[model samples]
Target chain A: MRIAVDAMGGDYAPAQIVLGAVEAVRKYKCDIVLVGDEEKIKAELAKTGMANNPHLIIHHASEAIEMGEHPVEAIRHKKDASLVVATKLVKSGDCDGVLSAGSTGAATVAAKMFLKMIKGIDRPSIATPLPTTHGIALLLDSGAIVDSKPRDLTEMAMMGSIFSKYVYGIDNPKVGLLNIGEEETKGNKKVQATYPMLKQAKDVNFIGNIEGRDIPSGKADVVICDGFVGNIVLKFAEGLAVTLFQLIKDAIKNGGILAKLGAVLVMPALKKLGRRLDVSEYGGAPLLGVNGCCIICHGSSNAKAICSAIGVAIECVKNDVTGHIRDSIAEEELLANDSETI
Target chain B: MRIAVDAMGGDYAPAQIVLGAVEAVRKYKCDIVLVGDEEKIKAELAKTGMANNPHLIIHHASEAIEMGEHPVEAIRHKKDASLVVATKLVKSGDCDGVLSAGSTGAATVAAKMFLKMIKGIDRPSIATPLPTTHGIALLLDSGAIVDSKPRDLTEMAMMGSIFSKYVYGIDNPKVGLLNIGEEETKGNKKVQATYPMLKQAKDVNFIGNIEGRDIPSGKADVVICDGFVGNIVLKFAEGLAVTLFQLIKDAIKNGGILAKLGAVLVMPALKKLGRRLDVSEYGGAPLLGVNGCCIICHGSSNAKAICSAIGVAIECVKNDVTGHIRDSIAEEELLANDSETI
Candidate 1:
C-alpha cells in the first residue's frame, strides 16, 4: 500500500520529514510518496542516502501552509501546497492514506474537504491513544468539532469503539463519557442529554460516566467527549506530564550531591518513563468517520514522531477501521428502523 | 481564632479528623471545636493525648452526610450533621473558619446557605492550589458551578487574584483565562465573552488566554475558568500524577533484581516526588465568595490531609481573603463606573 506524506509539514520540515519517510519505506516496506518542494525534498533525500530509493517518489508543490493560517481557507486557496496535494492523492485512491505533521486544523479541513466522511456519518472525530495505568486508552473528539449535540456524541462513541477494536486490537472496548463525576446525573446539560443516548447505542460497549481521574487509569478503552472538553483534557494531561518530569529533573539537579548521585543511579528508569509519556511514541491521532485513513501528527513532531505516524497510517489502512465503523453504524441504523416499524 | 472541624468527615472519620483538630489546637494556637458525635470524637481525641487540651471543644452532631448525597438537600435537611454544624459555627461568629474533609458539594451548599456569600459577590468559587514547575498556581472554580456565564468567569478571576495575593503571598499575581489555545480568538462562547470583561476589570492582574498545556508550568499565578473546565483539568492532573507514580512502582516491582536494586536506591527521591504531587499536601480547596473562611478537603482525606485543611483554614482567616476579595471587587465596580463617566 502507498501512503502520501506531507514533506513540508512540522517544525523540522524537509530534513526530518524526508529522513522519516525514507526510514518508513525501508522498515515498513510500503511505497512512500513525498509531497513538498521538489528541490528541497531531493536535497534532504540525498543527505539520508536514499536519493535513488525505488520505493520512494516525490510530488512537487510550491507553497507551504503556515500553522497560523485559517484551516478551510488554506486548504481551498493553497491547492498546490504539499498538504493539499497529498490529501488529494488519498481522495483519488492513488494512495491508501495521507499523513501530515502540519497544522492540525489544516490537516483536518483538508481531510474533510477532499476525502469526505463515509456515508451515514454526520461528523468526523479525532482519536489519540493516551498512555494510562492499565494500558493505552483511546480519547476521541480531541479537537475536531467544537460544539456537539447529544447524537453527535453517540456517533463519536460508536466510531471510537470500532477504531479501538481494529487499530488498538481491543475487543469489546468499553466506551465511557468523560464527565465531572462518575454518576449519570452529573455534568452540564450537554453531558446530561448525551448520557441516555450513549446508553442506548447498540454498536458500542457503553460504560457510564467516567470522571477525569479515570482517564489516566484506562478505566474505559474508548473515552468519548465533545471536542471542547476532550481537547482541554488531552492538552492538560500532556502539559502536566511534561511539567512533572521537568520538576523531577530540577529537583535532582538542585537537591545537593546526594540527590545528584541518586539521579545518576535512576536515570535509565526515568528516561524510560519519559518515553512512555511521550505522545509521539503512540503515533498520530486518527480522524475517524472519514472515507479513508488520515493521521494528524503534532506540528512540532521530530523524525521519530513522523515515522511512528506513518506506522499508524499503515495500521489504519490494514485494519479497515473506517469501513468497519461505517458498516457497524449502518447496521445499527437499520435495526433502529426495523424496531420502529414493529 | 476558633475553627470548627467536622470530626465525622472523610474516609478515616473520627480518628483522622479528631486527631487533626487536637493537633491544630496545640500547634497552631487556635481554639478548635470538633463537630460530630460527642462520644466518638472524644474517644478518638483521647488517643492523641488531647483529651484535656484547653483549646479543644466538642459540639455534638447526630448525622453524617454521605459523599454521594445531593448538596442542597443534604445541607437543608441534615441540620444536625457534622458539616452543617461546622458551617453554622462560622455563621454565628463562634468560629473564624470551618474545615471539613467531606462531600465538597455539601460543604459548598452549607457555606453558601449558612455563612452566605460576601457582599457584592454573585457566586462562590472553589480555589485549589496546583503544583507547578515554577511554584504553586491557584486554579479557581474547580467544581462549584458547572454552567457558568462570562460574568461568572470574570468574577472567578477577580476572586482568584485576591486569594493568590493574600493567601499565597504574591504581590501582583498574574491571572489568566484557561482555554484550548493561547490565541485571543480561542475557546468557547463563555471564554470569548469573558476575555474582554476580565481585561476591563481593574481588580485583577489579567493575562491573555493561556492554553491547557501551560498550566502545570505555573505560567500564571492564578488560572481562572468556569467550574466545568477547571474541574476537568484539576482532576486530570491529579489522575495523571497518580497513574504515573503507580506505573513507576509497577516497573520497579517487575524489573528483576538489578532494576529492583536501583529502585531501592532511588525510593527516597521517588517518595519525595510523590508527596509533591499529592493533592492533600496542598491543603483543602477554599470556597471563595463566602462571608467567612470555608475549606473543603477531599472526602477520602486522612489525618495528614485534615491537618493541612485546618492549616489552610487558619491561613485564609489570618489573611482575611474573603474580605480582601469583596473590597477589591467593590473598588473595581467603582472604577468601572468612573470609566463609563469619562
Candidate 2:
C-alpha cells in the first residue's frame, strides 16, 4: 500500500518527517511517498543513509503552508502546497491514504475541498483516542465542526462506533453522549435533544449520558459531542496533565538531597507511568467521514509518533474503515426511509 | 457575622458540619446558626463539647434533601429542608450569609427561591475559584444556568470581576471569555455572540478570548462561560487530578522495594504539593447574583473544608460582595439605557 506523507508539516518539519517515513517503510514494508520540497527532503533522507531505498519515493511540491495562515485561504492560494499535493495523490487513487501534522483547519479544509466527504455524510469529525483506565475512549468532533447540530452529533456517534470497532478492535463499541449529568433530562438543549436519538439508534450501543468525570474512568468506548465542547475537553486534559507533572517535578527539585535521591530511584517507575499515558504511541487522531483516511498528528510529534501515524494509515487502508462508514450511513438512511413509508 | 450552616447537608452530615461550625466560632470569632433537625444538630454539637457554647445556635429543620433528588422539585416539596431553612435565615436578616455542601442544584434552587435575584440581573451564576500556577482564577456560571445567552454571559463577566476584585483582592481582575481559540472570531455561536458584548462591557476588564489550556496557566483572573461548559471543565479537572494521583500511587506500589523506599523519602514533598493543589483550602465556590451570599462546598468536603466554607461565607458578608454585584448590574442597566437614548 502507498501512503502519502506531508513532509513539510509539523514543528520538526522535513527532518523528523523524513526520518519517520524511512522508518515506516522499513518497519511496515509499505511504500512511502514523501511530499515536500525535493532539496530539503533529499538532504534529510541522505542523513538517514536511506536515500537510495526503493520503498521511499520522493514526490516534490513547490509551496508549503505555515501553521499560522488561515486554513481555507492558504489551501485555496497555495495550490502546490505539500499537504494539498499529498491529498491530491489520494484523490487520484495514486495513494491509499495521507497523513499530516499541520494546521487541523488546513488539513480538514483541504480534505473536504479535494478528497470530499463520504456519501450521506453532512459534516466530518476528528475522532481523538484518549487513554483511559480500562482502555481507549474515542472522543469525536474534537474541533472539526464548531457548531454542530443534533443530527451531526448522531453521525459522529455512528462514525466513531465504526472506527473504534474496525481500527481499535472493540466489538459492539459502547457509544455515549457527553453531558453534564448522567440522567436523560440533564445537559444543554443540544445534548438533551441528541440523547434520545442516540438511545434509539440501532447501529449505536448507546449507554446513556456520560459526564466529564466518566471520561478518565472509561465509562464508554465512544464519546460523542459537538466540536466546541470536545475541543475544550481535549485541550484541558492535555493542559492539566502537563501542569500536574510539572508540579510533581518542581516538588522533587525543591526538596533536599534525600528527595533528590528518592527522585532518582522513582525515575524509572515514573517514566513507565508516563509511557502508559503517552499519546505518541497511540498514533494520530483521524478525521472521520472523509473520503480517504487522513491521520493528523500533534505539531511536536517526533519520528516515533510520525512512524506510528503511518502505521495507523496502513491499518485504515487495510480495514477499509471509510468503506464501512459509508455503508453504515447508507443503511441508516435506508432505515429512515422505510420508517417514513410505514 | 452570623452564618447559617446546613447541618444536615453533605456526605458527613451534621457531625462534620457541627465540628466546622464549632471551629469557625473559635477561630473566626463568629456566631454560627446550625439549621437542621434540632436533635441531630445538638447531638453533633455535643460531640465537639460545644453544646452549651454561646456562639452556637440551633434552628430546627423538618426535612432534608438527598443528593439524588431533583433539585427544584425537592426544594419546592421540602420547604423545611436544611438548605432551604439556612437560606431563609439569610433572607430574614437573622444570619449574614449561608453555607452548604449539599446537592449544588438544591443549594442554587433554594438560594434563588429565598434570596431572589438582584434587581436588573436575570440569572445568577456559580463562581468557582480554581487553584492556578499563580494564585486563583474565578470561573463563573459553573453549573447554575445550563443554557445561557450572550447577555447572561456578559452579566457573569461583570459579576465575576466584581467578586474577584472584592473577595480575592485582585485590584484589576482580567475577565476572559472561555472559547476554543484565542481569536475574536472563533468559538461556538454563543461564545461568538458574547465576545463583542464582553469587550464593550465597561464593568469587566475584557481580555478577549482564552482557550481551555489557558485556564490552568492563569491566563485570566476571571474566566466566564456558559454553565454547560464550565460544569464539564470543573468536573473534568477534578477527575483528572484524582486519576493522575492514583496512577502515581499505583506506580510507586508496583515499583518494587527500591521504589517504596523512594516513596517514603518523597512523601513529605508530595504532601506539600498536594496541599498546594488542594481545592478545600480555597474555602468554597460562591453562588453569585443572588440577593444574599451563598457559599457551596463540595459534597465530599471534610470538617476542614466545611470550616473553610464558613470562612468564605464570612468573607463575602464582610466584603459586601452581593451588594457590589447588585450595584454593578444596576450600573450596566443604566449604561444600556443611556446608549439606547443616544
Candidate 3:
C-alpha cells in the first residue's frame, strides 16, 4: 500500500520527514510519496542514500501550509499546498492513507475538505492514544469537533470503539463518557445528553461514566468527550508530564553526591519510564471518521516520531479502521430514526 | 480568627483533622472548632495532646455526609452533618471561615446554602491550586458551577484575580480564559462567548486565551473555565502526577541492585519533588465568591493536608477575599448588564 507523507509539515520538516519515509520503506515495505517543494525534498532525500529507490516516490507540490495558517482558509486558498495535495491523493484512491506531523488544524481541514467523511458520519474526530498502566487507552474527538451534540458523542463512542478494536486489537472495548463524576447522572449538558445515547448503542460496551482519574487507571479502553474537553485533557497531561520530569531531573542533579550517583544507577529505568509517558513513542493519533485514514503527529515530532506515525498510518490501512467505522455508523443509522441523528 | 473544620470529613477522619487543627492553632494562633460527633472529636483530640487547649473547641454534629451521597440531597437531608454545621458556624459569624475535607459537592452546597453568595456574585467557584514550575497557579470553577454561562466565566476571572492578588500577593495577576487554542476565536460556544466579556472587564488583567499546555508552564496566574473543563484538567493532572511518580518508583525498584541502591540515595530529592506536586502541600482550594471563606480539601487528605487547609482558611479570612469579591462583583455588575448574571 502507498501512503502520502506531507514532507513540508511540522517543526522538523523535509529532513526528518524524508529520513522517516526512507525508514518506513525499509521497515513496512510500503511505497512512500513525498509531497512538498521538490528542491528541498530532493536535498533531504539525498541524505537518506535511498532517493533513487523504486519504493520511494516524490510527487512534489508547489505550496506548503504553515503551522500558523488558518485551517479552512489555508485549504481553500492553498489549492496546491502539500497537505491539500497529499489528502487529494487519498481522496482519489491513489494512496491508501496520508500522514503528517503538521498543524493538526490544517491536516483536519484538508482531510475533511478533500477526503470527506465516511458514510453516516456527521463529523470527523481525532482518536488519540493515551498510555495507561494496563496499556494504552483511546481518547477521541481530541480537538476535532468541539461543542458536540449527543449524536456527535455517540458517533465518537462508535468510532473510538472501532479504532480500539481494529487498530489496537482490543476486543469489545469498554467505552466510557468522560465526566466529572463516575455516576451516570453526573456531567455537563453535552455529556449528560450523550450518556443515554451511548448506552443505547448495542455495538459498544458502554461502561457508564469515567472521571479524569479513571483514564490512567485503564478503567475503560475508550473514553469519549467533546473535542474541546478531550484536547484540554490530552495537552494538560502532556504539559504536566514535561514539568514533572523536569522537576525530577533538577532534583536529581541538585541533590548532593549520593543523589548524583543514584541518578547514574537509575538512568536506564528512568529512560524506560520516560518512553512510557512520551507521546512520540506511541505513534501519531489518527484523525478517524474521514473517508481515508489520516494520522497526525505532533508538530515538534522528530524522525523517530515521524517513523512511528508512518507505522500508525500503515496499521490504520491494514486494519481497515475507516471501513469498520463506516459499517458501524451505517448500522446505527439503519436501526435508529432520523431525529436520533441529531 | 476562628476556623471551623469538619473533624469527621476525609479518609483519615477525626485523628488527622484533630492533629492538623492543633498544628494550625500552634502555627497561626487561630482558634479551632472541630465539628463532628462529640465523642469521636474528643477521642481524636486527646490523641493530639492538645485536647485541653482553650483554643480547641468541639461542636457536636449528629450526622456526617458520606463521600458517595448526592451533594444537594445530602445537604438538604443531613441537616446536622459536620460540613453543614461548619458552614453554619461561618454563617452565624461564630467563625471567620470553614474548612472541610468532605465531599466537594457537599462543601460547595453547604457553603452556598448557608453562607449565601457575595453581593452580585452569579455563582460560587472553587479556586484550586495547581503546582507549576514558577510555583502554583490557581484554576477556578474547578468543580463548582459546572456548565457555566458567559457571565459565570467572567465572575470566575474576577474572583480568581482577586484571589491571586490578595491571597498569593501577586500584583495585577495575569488572568486567562482556558480554551483549545491561543486564538481569541478558537474555542467552543462557552469559551468564545466568555472571551469578549473578560476583555471588556476593565478591572481584570485579561491576557486573552491560554491553551492546556500553558497551565503547567505558569504562563497565567489565574486560568478560568467552566467547572466541567476545569475539574477534568485538575483531576487529569492529579492522576498523571500519581502515575509518573509510581512509574519512577517502580523503575528504580525493579532495576538491578545498583538501581535499588540509587533509589535509596535519591529518596530525599524525590520526596522534595513529590512535596512540590502534592495537593496537601498547597492547602485546600478556596470556594470563592461565597459570602464567607470556605476551603475544600481532598478526601484523601492526611494530617499535614488538614493543617495546610486550616492555614488556607486563616489566610482567606485575613485577606478578606470574600469581602474583596463582594466589592469587585458589585462593581462588575454596575458595568456589565443584566441577563449576564445567572
Q: Give DockQ per model, in order.
A: 0.54, 0.75, 0.75
Q: What TM-score quantifies how close candidate 1 is to the native fold?
A: 0.96
- Model 3 segments more than 4 A misplaced: A337-342, B335-342
Candidate 2 local lDDT, residue B192: 91
Each candidate's interface RMSD, rounded to one decimal? 2.2, 1.0, 1.1
Candidate 3: tens digits of C-alpha lDDT, residues A54-110: 988999899998988898898999999999999999999899999998899999989
Please provide, for model 2 over A1-342, each residue's C-alpha lDDT reduced to its tens digit, 9 standing for 90 to 100: 999999999999989999999989999999999999999999999999999999999999999999989999999999999999999999999999999988888999999999999988998999998988888999998999987999899999999998899989999999988888999999989999998889887689999998888888888999998899899999888877777778888998898888888988887898898888898888889999999989998888889899999998899889999999999989988998999999
Model 1: CA > 4 A from native: A256-258, A270-275, A335-342, B268-276, B332-342
How many backbone clashes does every candidate have?
0, 0, 0
DockQ of 1: 0.54
What does candidate 1's lDDT look like per residue over B1-342, in tens digits? 888998888888989888777767766888999999999988887888888888999999999998889988988898899999888888888999999888888888898898888777888889989888777899888999888888888888888887888877898999988887888787777788889988888778888998788888788999888787788877887777678778887766665565666666656665787688777787788999988999988877887777788888888899888888878878877887898999
**Cα distance off (Å), candidate 2, residue A102:** 0.5
Full candidate order by lDDT, most accurate first = 2, 3, 1
In order of appearance, the predictions have TM-scores of 0.96, 0.98, 0.97
Write down the lDDT that model 3 would get. Answer: 0.88
The TM-scores, chain A only, for the candidates as listed are 0.97, 0.98, 0.96
The global C-alpha lDDT for each of the candidates, from Candidate 1 onward, is: 0.85, 0.91, 0.88
